[model samples]
Each structure stands twice: as structure tokens, then as C-alpha cells.
Target: MSAEAPARPVGSPRRPGVKMALLAFCMLVFSVDYNIVYVALPEIGREVGFSAQSLQWVVSAYSVGLGGALLLGGRAVDRLGARRMLVLALALYALASTAGGLATEPGLLVAARVVQGLGGALLFPATLSLINTGFEEGPVRNRAYAVWGTAGASGAIIGSLVGGLLTDYLGWAWVFFVNVPLCVLAVAGCYAWLAPDARSGDSRAFDVHGALLATAASTLLVYGLINGPEAGWSSARTLTTIAVGLVLGVAFFAVEAKAADPLAPPRLFGYRGLLTAMLIIFVFQGAINTLHYLFFIQLQDVLGYSPLEAGLAFLPMSAVAMLGSGKLLPAVVKRWGVRGALFSGLTGVGASMIVLSLTMSTDTGFLPLLPAVLLWGLFAGMIYPAMFMAAGSDAAPDEQGVASGLTQTSAQIGGAVGMALLIAVANAGLDLNEGAANSVGDVVDGLRLSALTGGIAAVAGAFLAFRIKPPRAARQDGSATEAPPEPETVHSA
Candidate 1:
């Protein structure tokens, strides 16, 4: 065990249900915030003067910050304590939400998003660490993770609906404003149910160099990707930025190799299934985020759907996703194992994206989109929960926190890079010059290419999912230990 996490003391029973709920809520906020700003992009642009291309920053900024800090935050959770970090993250979330809601300019709004993403980065790893550590490893932990995954999927749907309602009825600002009360409630839940961290006897120094190198590498890479298409990809600035990012990435690994107290300790990567899990997560999350980003824009920009209608269109899919994650996934994992579940889910998601790519039309209504949406959700439910379980629990028990952060970091970085690539593909032949005449055909062309790119990525994820091996079951000597008793906290379905 690293000199960070200490074992829970004997006889102080934990409230597992309450713990799951609180952690799930935090996860919900992360997923919800990801897509909440999506539906409001049009409104946000109108009010704050964001061009179509410039609007990507509003979304990418958050991911860049979140991805960059996630690993470090996870280590902090191990060293600093999950409860303390989570409480602070929640407070930061509330403040960031307020700042975002009140922003009058594009820069301010993006800055606020960065802050919000940072909060999410810290909160995500801590929540997963807590869940992994708090629950005994078995069926109960699996179910808890499934519920947690369900909350995140459902939150994505809720975000779209909430964003639409608030944007249509109130204004775009309310989308950000709504998070304040919800975060406060989450903070309260943290205090009420979360167990205090058990401190290690030995103290370890923070790996500041590792953190800086990792963060700079990721940020530079994302910035280059996002900016590449806008400024000619062959331009010196774009090339130099990308090269610098690569160098930083090399430096980061080197730092990790020699550091006495590395942020991502070497032992964390020694686990069998972790590398495969992280790779699968990177591609899968990237594809899903790309789908959401383009689908929303396609609905509004091409089909001329109102925010409410577009949001409503996602309701059925969200419900299906929630059901799959909450109920169907646990059963599938039980029968097929984690790898089997992942393969099945990835196949569904990949097929859905491919079908959507082939079927998308300029003149179509909501009906054409329904089949793909439903398929994506159904598979996603299985994929998300299984992936989380595989990543968070497959590692040595002490390294669960690092595993959680690494998985999430892969997800955020993948989403950011995927969006950039798709955006670049979509915008290839379009006239994005300010005050230039634009046609709906140009937009449709971009959307079609973007869908195709996303489909290919998802299909690749399915292929990569095959690499994940099932976690090894812990061995027992002679007697089977009975599972821990459930706590008396209110349970979510």
C-alpha cells in the first residue's frame, strides 16, 4: 500500500447506501455539466456573441481542465482524504456555477467553465475512490457502481431537458445557475454520510513536477487540436504547439519514472486489466461526447428543432439508458463477466453510431434519430458501469484511487481530442470566415462527416474492448466471509 490510504478501523460501520447516493450525485453533476451547456450553445452564442467555431471552447475548456487535474486530484484524495477534497470541490462547484451563470462575456464564461471543470476533476476521483474503498469487494460493490453509473447517464438526459426548459422559459444563464442548489445539497450529503479518511502513518511529498508536466502536456495537446483547423493545420504555430505538447508528454513519463513520490506511481500501472480499461474508456468516451456535441448542433442547425423539442427527443433514450445501467447491466456483468459486458455494450454503441451516420438526412424529423439514440443509450448503460467497475476495482486495493483518476483522465482527454478531430473534419470545406455567406448544405455536410468520424471511433472502441480481461477474483482460505451489513441510509433505486 502507498503511504497515503490507511485501512478503515474495525467496528465503525459504514452507511453504504447513503455513501453510494452521495457519490452518485457528484458523478451526476459531472456528467450533467458536460452536456448542460450543449443544448444552450445557441442561446449562449446569441447573448454573448460566440461564433459557431468559437463555441467549441465553451465545451472544450471544461474538459481540458478536468482531464488535466484528474490524476493529481485522485492522488490528492489518497493523500489529503476523500471527504475533505470532495467538500472543497463541491464548494468550488457552487461558486463556479454562479460565476458561469452571471458571465457577460465569452472569456468570462469559458473561465468559469474551467473552474467548474477543475472542481469536477477533484470530485470525480474522490467519489470513485470513496466508493471503491468504502464498499466491500463483491456483488454489493458491483451494484453500487451500477447505480452510480446510472446516475451519470440519467444526469446527461436531465441536463439536456433542464437546459432546454431553462433556456426556453427563463434564459441560458439558468442552466449554470441551477447547479448551485444541487451542489449545496450534494455537499450536505457528503458531510452526513461519507466516512472520514484513514490516514497513513508515513507522509509522502506531493509530486508537483509530475502534476505540472501532465497538466501542461494535456492542455497543450487539446489547445493545439482545437486551434489546428481554425488556423491552418500546417501553420508554424499549430505544429509548434503540438510538438511542445508531445515533448511535455515525454517529460511527464520521464518524471514519473524517476520521481520518489510520483503522482502516478509505477505500481498503479502494474495491474493486468488497467491499461486495457483506460484505452477502451478513452475511445468510448470520446465517441459518446462527439455524438452528443454534433447531434445537438445537427438538431438545431439542420432540422430547425427548438431547444425544448430537441431536449424532449433525448428523453426516451435517456430513460432506456437509465434502465440499462441500473438494472440490465448488473445482470449482464454477472453472466458474461466485465469483458463480455464491455464487448456487448461497445458493439451496440458502435453499431448505433454507424447507423446514425448512414441514416442522417437534412429533411428528416425526430423519428429518424430515435433508433440510433435508443441503441446508443442501451449500450452505454452497460459500457459505463462495467468500465468503471473494471478500472476502479481491477487494480490492487490500495491503487484504486489512482486507477479511478487515470480512467477519468483518459475519458476527459479522449472526449476533448475526439471533439477536436470531428470538429476539424466537419469544418473542412466550410466557409467559417466572419461575415461570409453560409449555407445549410455546408452545415449538413459537416455533420455527416462528423457522424462518420464518431462512428469509426466507436467501432474502434469495440475492438479495443476485446483487450480487457476480467478482474481476478480474490481467494479465500477455507471459510467464506459473510458480506458486510447494509447501512441504514435511504437507498436509491
Candidate 2:
């Protein structure tokens, strides 16, 4: 009875699972590089004289570059085709990793990291876009995303362990080298599994103005935050960076508001639940990442664990993170609703951090910190995926990539900001100690201060949990039907 042939449902990509694994593997590489390097910093410093301030660059550079590019990367994939961009990104990743490994000078290594970050910025979002493209809508997409989310969390744990083994025995360079193989494998495997998806030419134009303003603002803000306490909070450079960052941020918003195709859609934030969820996630991701930095540094430096020993110390946290995130998260959400899980996770994480603040001692055994770490890991596992799911819950199908990008951008920027703030707090009120362990007392004090910041942030997250709505079932009987008013938009349950 129809005048025209039935409109086609978009064809699913061939061998989606293989493509998903390749993407997951790339995420593992980047995350491991990020988390693993923090633990290995002392070794790096000892090998080549690294001032405390200089050492922070090793971590911050990656964040700066990666955070700077993620938004545009999402847009780029949408236009350029996910497959093409992903291959290019992987090539860049391998090149940077190789360069990073070969560098002897700190400046060179840091520069390599900036390049590596660029590759990651492109790679991650493209991969996420591919996943959203490949998976069928509803339970299939949710489960695919859940698995994607789990790999990233588990990868952090895995990275720390692998990085420790590599750094301890093989040297820190090996940590970077490991990525090269994975990059090759990922590209080759992806070639076999992931063909190009349906292309939309709408995403073509690069937003140079948006990218520069956003990157400048993020970098300046981070630099100011990290440098301020040490440089005198009111120092000219510190003050200038923050001031310029504010101006750039204002410009960025203006540019987006007027641009025909904005990097960030203004209406996206109108989804009240998604916006709040992003903020809460930003706060907690920082809280969680910084704690890993504190715990491992203490374990190895004060408790006199070898890299191997430190790796062992973190095993339980990884295990708990896996159990909680992989197995418990979806089930919990199924029963309690999104708000309930968000509240439970925030409360648990905050309480756990508070409990951890009590457990700090340079000489304390791992047993003393076990319960706190376990709780921290479980809560973190619960928090991340729920928020990730929340971000796209109401997003239009075509816009899922953008939704994922904003969610990750919030995560990266939050991580950089929160980390700088917490570390500044740790650096505050410290008496200089010449020892590598830096006076066990100073270390303990810093850990406590960092934990305090995280605990406080988590407490705030609890109050924000009420904003999220539970997921709804997708419509089944397919047609050129109207897009449902994104099920989770204002869901009560």
C-alpha cells in the first residue's frame, strides 16, 4: 500500500565484535600508559634528575593534549568516517609511543606525550562512534557500551600491573613500547572486522576556533591550578593564566552558540539529567584517579615495595573494580533505578575515601588499606558506567557519538582539574624532605589532604544524584517512525 519501497534500517557493520575488541584494546593502551606512568615516576626521576614541578609535566601533558582534542575528535569521526579516522589515529599512536620510548630528555619525552595525547584524542572517540554504529539499538547497544565501559576500568587496573612489571624489570621505556604492538594488532584486526559505516557529510568542517579556545582555556586553567600554590596563588603568571583561561572559555561558548555546526550542541545540555550527571562524573573521576597516584607512591616509596610489590598491592583494588563494575553494576541499576545507584555509589565512594583518610601511614601494611581500597574500587566501578549510560540515555540515535564525546570530555577535564587541585592541596603545608620517601610523615599528610579533597567532592556528588532518570525500553516494530522522546529524559524511576 506504500507509495515507495520500505525505507532501509541502517545496515550493521560486519563483524562488530572484532571491531569492538580492537577499540577496547586501544583504550587499554592509552589508559595503561596514563596510570602506569604515574607509578613509575620515581624511577624516572631517579634515572634522570626530575624536579618535582618538572615531574608533573609527565602526567599533565597527556591530559592537556587528550582533553584538548576529544570534542573535535568526536565530530571528526562523524564526518571523516569512523574507520578512516581510527586507522590514522592508531598510526599516530604507534609513532608517538615509539618516539616517547626512544627519548632520553624530559622535554622530548613530554613532547612525545603531547603527540600521543593527540592520537588518543582522535582514537578514543572514533572507536566509541564505531561501537555505537555497530551495535543494534536497545539492550544490544547498552550491553556493548557496558562492555566497552568495563574494559576501560579494568584496563586501568591492568595497566598499573603491567606497567609495574615492565618498569621494574624491563625499564619505563618498555611501558611505552608495549603499545606499539597493540597498535599494529589493533589496526590489522580492525581492517578485517570493521568496514566503513554510513557516512554523514554534515560533520566535515573543522572548528579551529572552538578547538584552540577550548584547548587554551583547559591548559591555562590546569597550569594555573597546578602552579598556583607553589608559585604563590596571586603570582602574576598564575593569575594571568587563570584570567586568560576565563576569557578563552567565554569565547569558546560564544563560538559554539553562533557556529552553524557546533562542536558541542547547546541543546544537548538541555537534557537536565545528562548535564548533571556529567558534572558529578567530572568530580568523581578526579577523586578516583588522584587516589591511585597517592596510594601507589606511598606503597612503593614509604612501605619499601618493589615495583612488583606495589603492583601486588594494587591487585585487590583491580579485582574489586572488576567485580563491582562488570558484574554488579547493571544488576544494581536494574533493581534500584539510576538515581538509587548514583546515590549509593556516591555515598559509598565518599565514605570509603573518608575511611581511607584514616588508614594512611608510611609504614602501614596493605592489610590496613584493603577494606578502603576495595570499597573505593567497587563504588568507582558502579559510578562510571551508570553515568556513561546516563549521558546517552536521551540522546538521539544520530547524536550518540556526540553524547559519548561530551561525557568523556567531562571526564578528562574533570580529571585534570580535580587532580591539579588535590595535588596542590597535597603540596600545601609540606615541609621539604630530601629523602626519596620524603619523610614518611610528609607523604602521609599529603595522602590525607588528597583523600580529604576527594571525600569532600564525593559528598557533593551524593546531593546531585537525584537528577538522573532511569532508562526506558526502546520501540520495536520498526518504521520511519518518529524518534521517541528519548526515554530517560525525565524518567522518574
Candidate 3:
């Protein structure tokens, strides 16, 4: 494999529609895998003999693995070909899922999940890079992203539902077993449909030091954030871990500055809308994940809904989100542009959160939650694809993988931070030490406070959305143009 391969005829795939569908399907599989385990965690703990505290490793291990490997995966996608990386990622998923399904102990299942997450790190960047590089910018790429976003949103909701059904009827193992066939199909489809990588003779060296630093920083940072709430925010262990991660992050940047071939070139940050896009994604992801966490707690703890019922409760919002992604997002982007669409979406999400704060109560039924749920879905559809579109807006074809990686990294970190902070806020004034039960009123109040905080964060994200400037050609001529040559050095955006 070579670093500078001749570009493989960008935007010229045969049966592009089918290719887009396959890519979207891959996204769906990853999304489903992410959430499906949540509903099965209790079953997994009981069967695998996991203690209450250690059971969280089942989820945190995956997060740590995905967060750590994303930069490396993205670099690989650019160095190797998207099709090759996609096949490799899907194969990993298939193998890991099988291992997970057959695991008789907690350690094996957790290890399998970590491998699955590493696979996701590769799959996400590869899928997004293919979309960005395969379709022409503007309407074609926007639509492709919308379809991809629809799959992601729908798959998440479906995961919860499927997990509940599988865990109850078939067993928790089925949750892992299910991914095997889907991954195999995706791998087969990739071989049959995706074009081969362009041949290259250039053999630029890989940035080993930069990759190691970035991976270590990401993994440690995510680990600390995920455990901070449980370990106490001011705890020495959590603070020390986060501090070390930050130090490593700074070291990674310094190494990148000097590397012959940096894993993540600093120049990528100079693209017009890229940094702002990353910021918006960070905030948007944080807000969305916090909202989901709060609602999950509310539905099950406050409203006394069963796992299956709680899963069913999300259907309306998921349906609307999918509908908006498929039908409304393109039109919104066409009329208002990416910035406007993001602004509108973030604002809507904020308003929805505030409304949820006011409406949710122990005495209330699901009907009162509908207004906020529908509002979140309608706007979230716009935000999901718009942020990615913005990130890819002026990125060169060869850099799409790393560009996608940067935003995805932001998303992972943001989700962790948001969950940690908001969950802490939600648990305020409540004694959660070793089985202390909170009253319904106290829980409701905490939920309201957390939702309010999430709403404020979303509004801040909407303001940041305006910071995304139009692409250079669009601003100059009011028309889109192809991306310019990559800059020789990093420059201020």
C-alpha cells in the first residue's frame, strides 16, 4: 500500500444508488451494534457472573476501543483503500460477534466487544469516506449523507427493540450472534460491488509515534470520562487519568508537527468549514446523548415502564427522524444551506429539551412527552447529516477519511463528557451511595434540571453553527466548485 496513490476516478461508480444503499446498510449495522447491548446488559451480568460495578466494562471497553482506534482506522482507510478497509472491518465484526456469542464468561464477552469497537472505528470512517469521495458535492452528496443518517437513527431505535426481544425469547447471546450474518453480507457486498483500490508506487512511511500518542490520549481520556461520575469527579484516579490523557494529546500534536507523514495532518484543520463543523458535532452529539440517557432513566425508573415498553416508546421519534432525514433534510439544506440547517436543527433540539423539562412528570403519561420527542426528531434529522456535510465540504478527496475521523473523535469525546456531566447534575442532592433509593419527586426534579442544562448546551451549539462559513468558491461566486489542492502547510481557518 502507498500513501499517494493515483486517485481512483472519484464520483464515477457504476450503480451508485446500490453502492449508497450498501454503505447505508453498513452504518445501520454499526449503529445497531452500539445500542443493542444496553438492553441485554442485565442478562449478560447475571449469566456471566459479573459484579454490579464490573458490568459497566461491557460497555466502557467498547467505547475505549472505538475512541482509541478511530484515528488509526481513518489513517488506514486513506492509506489502504476504502473497500479494503471496509472488508477488513466487517470481517472483524463478524469474528468478534461470533466470539461474543459463544463466550461463557464475562472476560471473553468484554474482550469481544472491544474488538467489535475497533472494527467500528474502521467501518465508520471508511463508510463516510466512501460517501464523501464517491458522490459529487452539493445535492448528490447531501442526499447520500441523509440516507446514511436515516439508517443510523433508525438502527439505534431498532437495536433497543431487537435486544429486548432477543434477550427475552432467544437469550442474550443472540444479540451478539445477530451481527454475524449482517456483517458477512456487508463483506460480500463490498467485494461484489465496490471498486478496487488504485495501484500506487509511492511508499511514504507511516507516522507510528503520532498514531500511538493519539490512540493513547483518546483511550485514556474516554476511560476517565466514562468512569469519572462513578469514581467521584474529584477523585485522584479520575483526575490523574484525564491529566495524563491531556498531556499525551499535546504530545501527539507536537509529534504530528514534526512527522514526515503525520497520521493526522494539521493542514486538514485549515479547511474552511472543518473546524466549525467539528465543534458543532461535538456539541450536537453531547446534547443528543445526554437527552437519550436522561430519557432512558426517566422511562424505566420514573415511569415504571418495562424494557420492551420503553423501547417501543422511542418508535414515534425514530420514525419521524427517519422520515425527516429521507424527505426533509435535502430540501432544508437546499433552501437554507448547511449552516442554516444546522442552526435550525440545534435550536429545535434545544427547544425540545426545554419543553421536555416542563412536561415530564411522574404523573404524566407518554402523551405529554410527544411534543418534545417529535421536536427533537424533526430537528435532529437536519443536524446529523449537516455536520458531516460541513466537515467534508471543502476537504480534498484523499483527506476525507481523516476528516471524518476528526469529527467522529469529537463526537465520541463529546458523548462521554456530556453523559458524565449531565448525569452528575441529574444526580445532584441525591445520596446514591451504595443502594440509596431516591424518591420519585427527587428523580423528576433531577431529570428536569439535567434536561434544562442540555437545552442550554444545545442553544450554544446553534450559535456555533453560524461560525461555519460558506466554502471559498461559494462565497466568491455563489456557486459550488471542486476542492482546491491541499495546502503545503497548516494555516489558520
Best by TM-score: 3
**lDDT (CA) for every model shown?**
0.78, 0.72, 0.85
**In model 3, what lDDT does residue 55 have?**
91
What would the per-residue lDDT of candidate 1 be over residues 1-493, giving only the tens digit for each residue?
A: 3224434422123666777787888889877887788779888998998887888788878877787777778878777777888998889889999999999999999999988888987888777777766765567778888888899888978898988888989999999999899899998887777766666665777889998998888778767876776776899999998899899989998999999988887766655466767888888877887787677777888898887888888888788898889988889878877888888887788788787877677787778888998998899887887887778644544465667888887777676677767788888878877788768878777887788878876776676665655433323211111223233111210
Worst 10 residues of 3 by lDDT: 484-493
**Which segments of model 1 are wrong by more than 4 Å?**
1-13, 427-446, 471-493
lDDT of 3 by residue, 1-493 (tens): 2325433345346798998999999999998999888888888999998998889888888888898889889988988878899999999999999999999998998899999999999999999989877875557778899999999888977898899999999999999999999998998888887887776665998888998999999999999998887787799999999999999999999999988899998887776577888888788888888898888788998888887788888878887888778878888888778888889889999999999999989889899999999999888876888888888776777778888888888888998998888888888868898888888999999999999999988897798877666444455642232456322101112
User: What's the TM-score of every candidate structure?
Assistant: 0.89, 0.87, 0.94
The TM-score of predicted model 1 comes to 0.89
Please, what are the lDDT tens digits per residue for candidate 2 over residues 131-228? 65566544555556556667777777877788888887899888778889888988886677776566565535777788677777766775676556
TM-score of 3: 0.94
* Top candidate, metric lDDT: 3
